[model samples]
Target: MLWLSCVDETAPALPAAWLIATDAQPANLPERSALRRSLACKVLARQFGLPDAAVEIGHEPAGRPLILAPQGSGLHLSLATRSGLVAIALAPRPVGVDVEQVAPASEPPLAMLHPEERRWLASLPASARPETFAQLWSAKEAYVKALGIGFARAPESFAVRLDGAGRFVVDGARNGGPASGFVRLTKNGGHESMAAAFIVLDQA
Candidate 1:
């Protein structure tokens, strides 16, 4: 029961999720990427025949995603947003997702990378920095967000290295845990977005 969605940033036809953003002040909020993420889940609820108003979405203290109320028995979901594209995934188990615009990362994101990561960033040509960093950043962010720990763990705690084009390896050994994952980048709204998920283990 995994579901994923990509919304056109410039979609002339607005979907239901955008309403979550619209309720806020007109000029104060950043229109495009700054919207709250649960909007995507709200859209999914509608698609699943549930009332969007009944859904309860909250965040962990660490800023990781959370489900405040018990989700319906049949589904669990994850979402990612970048530039103007939004991706949503639904499955029968816990899930996590992240989307970062692939451009020059703001200073904050770069600062989150460890010295090792900085070295890796420095190794790449100036022109290649954004793409390389974004790919690796999104992957790890997705993973941690999946774990629901967020910044509680340092980004460098896990080791991520990219070799061949479209190939990535993540090693969490340094993070004191054996968690890791892979990702493939796709073009969304003319920006690079990476999506990753773990195959849910069926306990039943």
Candidate 2:
């Protein structure tokens, strides 16, 4: 299951919801960075009924989410940000999440893209301008988050193209079957945040 939450940073210790309890704080960077990380782990540990001290939450060498299990259960999480809001995604399998503040790109970050990305982003209609590019950024971020490589893996190294059907195209690979899970994007704090999870469901 996936959940999205927005919390006022000033407010401390809000109640936990169904799947996970999130202590979200919309604070500035440097001040809220550690708080955001702590809150995410706290909420996740609370979800699994683990004590705060028992759960070890650290950062990967590449600055990815690091979770130490006390019960030997398998789970993966990813977190990313843009300006204010910090987003988190959790799943039994591997999962990735990212949040970006959407704005009028006086100059979009497209200049940071390679030839292939430039061509892909340019192919979209003007009507789909920022939204399409925002989707692409969020999707790639989530994919890298899933891989646990973080930014060590180039965003352009993989491609995420969204079609009219709301499906995803990755590295010229389309998910037309029931293989991988879907991505969820929503507007939060005037930013675009996305979450992707791959679930292995057992059928009867």
Model 2 spans with C-alpha error above 4 angstroms: 6-29, 51-54, 69-71, 114-117, 125-127, 164-167, 172-181, 190-204
How well is each residue in 1-204 modelled by candidate 2, as lDDT tens digits?
Answer: 434454322112212111222234446665556655665666666666766667666677876676776546565656555444556555565566665444544345786554576787688676555666666666666666666666677665555556544445456322333223344445444434333322222221
Candidate 2's displacement at residue 158, Å, is: 2.8
Best by lDDT: 2
TM-scores vs. true structure, each candidate: 0.60, 0.67
In the order shown, the candidates' Cα RMSDs to the true structure are 7.1, 6.7
lDDT of 1 by residue, 120-192 (tens): 7887787778767776776676566556566577886766766554445556533344444445555554434
Clashes of 2: 0
> Candidate 2 has which clashing residue pairs, if any?
none
Error of 2 at 159 (Å): 1.9
Compared to the true structure, candidate 1 yields what TM-score? 0.60
Collision pairs in model 1: 2-90, 3-89, 3-90, 5-88
Give the runs in model 1 whose Cα sits over 4 Å from its true position: 1-3, 6-38, 46-56, 60-62, 67-70, 74-76, 104-111, 163-167, 173-177, 186-204
